[model samples]
Target: MKIRQKSREFIWGIYDFADTIFSMNVVSLYFPLLIVSDLGGKDIYVGLANSISQLLIVLTAPIFGIFSDRTGKRMPLFIISASLCAIGTLAIGFSAELGAILPVVIAFIFANYFYQLSLTFYNSLLPRVGPESRWGKISGLGTALGYVGSIVGMILVMPFNTGKIFGLNTFIPAGGRIATFTPTAILFAIFALPTLIYYLRDERRSKYPVDTVNRHPFKKIWETFSDTRRYPGIRRFIVSRFFFEEGVETAIVFMGVFAEKVMGMPDSAKIVFFVIATTAAVFGSIIWGKITDWLGPHQSLMLVLYGWIIGLIVLAIFPYRWLFYPIGCWIGIMLGGVWTTSRPYLLKIAPAENVGRYFGLYSLSGKAAAITGPLIWGTIILIFSGWNLFAAYRIAVATLAILIAIGTIILMPNKTLFEKHPIV
Candidate 1:
């Protein structure tokens, strides 16, 4: 990572562009709401569908990474993962069966699986992408570009009122449902071309040849588990990430729900909420990346986590929730910084050769505990007044605060100092 290089950076940036389109299409802009409102499913059902996706990642991404490292060819896996996700989006767009939740659920589950796996290869290429001095900056900038794609995709899809595109009324498939997803699907396919070109360009520079192996995939998987504990930094960061991410998932799972049900936000304004938050996160990633270089990872994370805590507090405390526009702004900032910066720190600490395997470990640890945060909030309502909403929301915020505090203490002691300054 110490040597300067942008060939990989420029190439990988193209993939980020593609990935942003996919995340916007599936995660942020269109799909989840389509299932809930147009398809007549419960919000909990949406969570279950995505939870299944993450659960699959918990089970499979590590195996995928082990294979990726053993094989050293990333583009094939990247191509396969992105294609499956795009095809899954196409299927979701065409599905009209309300009672056939099984198909819809399965489509989303597989889409997310591919989406998450792509990252295993993407991250494994980081050392080739740029200098160690610039990893934080490049990673942050790439993430910012990705978020820009999300915002732009949302805006593009916002104007299409018809059931068709390219003179095809593909939005309405069956059962009186408007299953349109033309907006980002085209973007996903088109934007992905550049990434393919880039990865193919660089396949031979790094570990592109497959490794010699006689052991089973399961044996390789066990080897990864045995290897992870030997690195204390990776293990600690994974544990800290799990606890802090509980709060992240809690807020994300319920933000819009709280807006419409508790804060009495206008229904039309919810998408606007998404656009704003994501846009903010885009910039926050850039800003925090610079700061992470300057202040070091531990200090930067502390600041970002505090911002997250305040964002949660404002979400719960303000009587006229609309008055918290500033909070929303900060939430965008903190979201970008928290996620993008946190990652490069792990990349910095991990052993140089095993990035793929450790990243798989990263996905497994964070995602396997994905249910803990949401279930805690769900319990607040179940144990208190099932009919009451806002009070339980406050409890969720309180719980998140505790998580942030505990993580800060554990994180501070293990912070890595640069040889000279924290940044280049």
Candidate 2:
């Protein structure tokens, strides 16, 4: 039993580790390039897809969360959603080969919707992984492993990025871009498998029991949604997180496009930049994991927010390929710190039995802001047509920096949130 429990914790890291494989390689790195360059599409398509996906997640995640809470089970939804995400990703590669944008868009919608749903279920599992005191370390371990996965995923897909298959003698002329999705899907499935299999059979007794009175899942979800005022600290934190996350998600979702249009960077260089950033993220996750436990989640979040503000400002000023090496590292560190700190903080203040619902709302806040960031970035690009491309990216990033600054102010006076969990 002890060994099995330890294995489950390790598998938790595997779950996170798999998520970034698709996130970095497919979504952040290749998809934007495919849209703009290969399919001759606009940034607005990317933005639309991103916004629509978030809208789907925002509407559906809480329903799923309420279901998990009502049923006292998480594995069923995890398995189904994750498997579909992999299949959807694989379909993307095939869609690219067919030279059809509609199929690719549909596949992206399928993959991203399930991808967001997967996180809600995965995060709800965090509270179940161990004691409350170890939440930071556990979340950090998973995030660190996630960055490591990002590095490995990027390396595996590098050949595809360059249009070269290592084993094949011939290159597929633009094949690398489309071929990337297949291998990424495979890698995601391989890492994600252990968790799915383990949880499928190994049901430990539930620490959070189902409520007897709440018979309808939708009713429970509605009540939870309406009762936000009861948790003022969480409400404030969610609002603040919404702002900063807008900055982070915008930067990440469009970094490839920015690199391509602004820096005139080749596909290979873009992959290298992601590798550098993800490597920095690994260290950031480890360092901040400790800080999360020591200084608490709120303080750790503040530190990362400061990093975002400074990093965005510097990148806006420079916006050069050569400079991205250092600038990417700064952004990576903050990226790691954000996920590492936020989850433990949410866990600290949430009602234990309602963990899934709260995380659903947590996902909602981020997704709600997520809808705006891509739209904002894509719209800014449209608004600045024929102007200096780099300047457009800079202005967009500057906008993000201002949002993060406001978020920093909102997050000030953390006394209320911290009072519940002093050490976090």
Candidate 3:
């Protein structure tokens, strides 16, 4: 790769690192606790909020994708999305003073919407940023850095969360969860700055023919979905992915809640658990990324899915708190494996001309998982919480395990996924 292309990769990797930091610290970890504990909200709100954000992504991401394709510009849109995310997060920090759950949820939803929406453009950049042969390595490096960011973000926010650093007393019913949000916004903004500034100079613009006069964006997205029949391999993989991703999203989104409600862990233990898991993830991404490139996505994905099954089963069945330590390590490995393998698989299979649109569909399918996973998990929890909290969590996890199994079974037959087969 040339120097400029390599630089883009490095900078985008940092961008992903910062993005993951925000996601792990705020979305996957702290936000749920804040809503349920600090804001005096219910556990179901965690799922509800996630489902709503993803539904919004499903509705709007393709529109943005199509628009970027038409305009032949992605960095500009990414810059706007990043800025909006920061503003929205700040709004959430302030929403605590409003003393209403609705405002805080709305602000969080806004921030999360842009945060996820921005990735459509980011994912599109991958095919253009570096050589396809090295895409797996680049993605793995980014995933590894992302885990490092997760660790750093966790450490950075620990002081405020425990009321130990800077003497900041932003507690709810006394003050608010501002300490968490304020620092998150600042960190996200600072980390995102380099991407916004450097990305503009990179020349990874859209290569597809620009449809300057295209109307009916929704219809265009629909037509693109209809065109999937032309690529059965990609189609089958995506459909299988939709089911398994539901389980993945649900489990990750609710793991913190499960730790609190079922394991009876307090905030301190939760932070420590995530740090250790994230440390494991850093290694997982590096190791599995090599495996992905060597064995190809199909074999590598199968290995990770099996790991996921074992992890979920262990989490559901193990009764002792001491068992969770090793379980967390296993979950981390699978988490890194799933992401690092799936994208390269898509890149290998997808037509180069329509990378943006296909990845948009990819985002949509992921958002579809986001919609179903949380809704299913929340509904199960609500139904069974009446009977027993632990039962609800157990059933929900089992449901995710079943979904993963189904996805794995569907994908198992696609050994020739990237090879052309007669469409007859």
Candidate 4:
């Protein structure tokens, strides 16, 4: 029984490893370069594409969540959403090959929308993976593996873009940024199979029948919002998450572009930089997971937020190109820490029976921030376009820093939220 349980947990984490390959290749690395650098689009174009996808997720996630909860099943939704995301990713590569920027952006919007939506179901699977006591450890292990996936994904996709693997000659010729999309899509599908198969064979049907009576999606959304008042810490945590997540999500979308434009880093150097940063993130996720278990999720999350505030400030002010490397490492650590702590933090505070609904709200908060954060970034960049290019980006980074600071302040008082109802 213990071994079977462990296998389930391991398989669950593998999905994290799987999805991040898409995130690394498509979202964080090649896609942005394809849009702005290769296709002669602007940063705003990338921002808008990201924001639009996130907007879609924000609108749909809660309903999806409510539906999952009502049906008492997550695996089927997870598989369907992930498959659609993979298809959309493939479409992106095909559209990019045509050199029609609009089609590529449209494909990206759909791919990213499904990709982000899928996470709500994925995250809701946490309780099923382990006992509540082990949630932090399980979440951390998944996050660490996900960063490892980022490293591996970058290396695997490198040959497609540069025609060289690890800076060596290879049979695969350089195919440019478009080459990355197909392989990334394929990899996402292939790796997700283990969890999909496992669930298909072993998942038990939910005892709860689908709630057909509450058919109005908007009313369901209203009830869920009203339901949160009964859960003490959830509202405050979600509100705080909105601010910090905006800064974090914006940073992820723009970091590649920022490196290219502000620091004058080449694609090869950027790959190396990300590898180093991901390595730091791997360790950070593992360490912070232990901290979350030890210090409790709320306190652990507070520390992570503080780290973001400090890191974003340093990134904004530091002028030297060499300094960017270390800052990337710092950002990566905080990045992993945020997801690592935040997942378990929500699990700790939320009622188990309503996990799906609350996680949907959790997704809503993050997606809502994702929608606005990129737009805010794009607007700031446009406003400062006439100034020194480096100065424009610097000011933008500082703005994200302020947002994180605000989130940290909002989160501070919630320390008391956990004290009254301690996790066992």
Tens-digit lDDT string for candidate 4 (241-347): 99999999999888899999998888899999999999999999999999888888988888888888888898888956789889889988988899999999999
Candidate 4's C-alpha runs over 4 A off are 205-215, 420-424
TM-scores, all models, native as reference: 0.85, 0.93, 0.92, 0.96
- The reply for model 3, stretches above 4 Å from the true place, is 1-6, 165-177, 204-215, 418-424
Tens-digit lDDT string for candidate 3 (139-247): 7877887888888877777776676423345343322245677778888888877777776765453353455657688888987788788866788788889988999
Q: Tell me which residue pairs clash in candidate 2.
A: none
Where in model 1 is the C-alpha error above 4 Å? 1-8, 97-100, 161-180, 205-215, 374-385, 416-424
Best by TM-score: 4
* Model 4 accuracy (lDDT, Cα): 0.87
Of the two candidates 3 and 4, the one with more favorable TM-score, higher being better, is 4
TM-score result, candidate 3:
0.92
lDDT values of the candidates?
A: 0.68, 0.84, 0.81, 0.87
Cα RMSD (Å) between model 1 and the true structure? Answer: 4.4
Residue 414 lDDT in candidate 3: 77
Poorest 10 consecutive residues by lDDT, candidate 1: 171-180
User: Model 1: per-residue lDDT, tens digit, 1-424?
Assistant: 3232555566576677777777755664355555555565555666666667777888888888777767777678878888887887777655544446667767767776787777777767777777777778877877787777777765555445333332345544322223335556677778777877676667855554344664787787788677767776666777787777777755665666556555666434655666777888888888988987777666677778778877776666763566545666777788778666777778777776667777888777667656566556556645554655667656666777677666656665555543424322
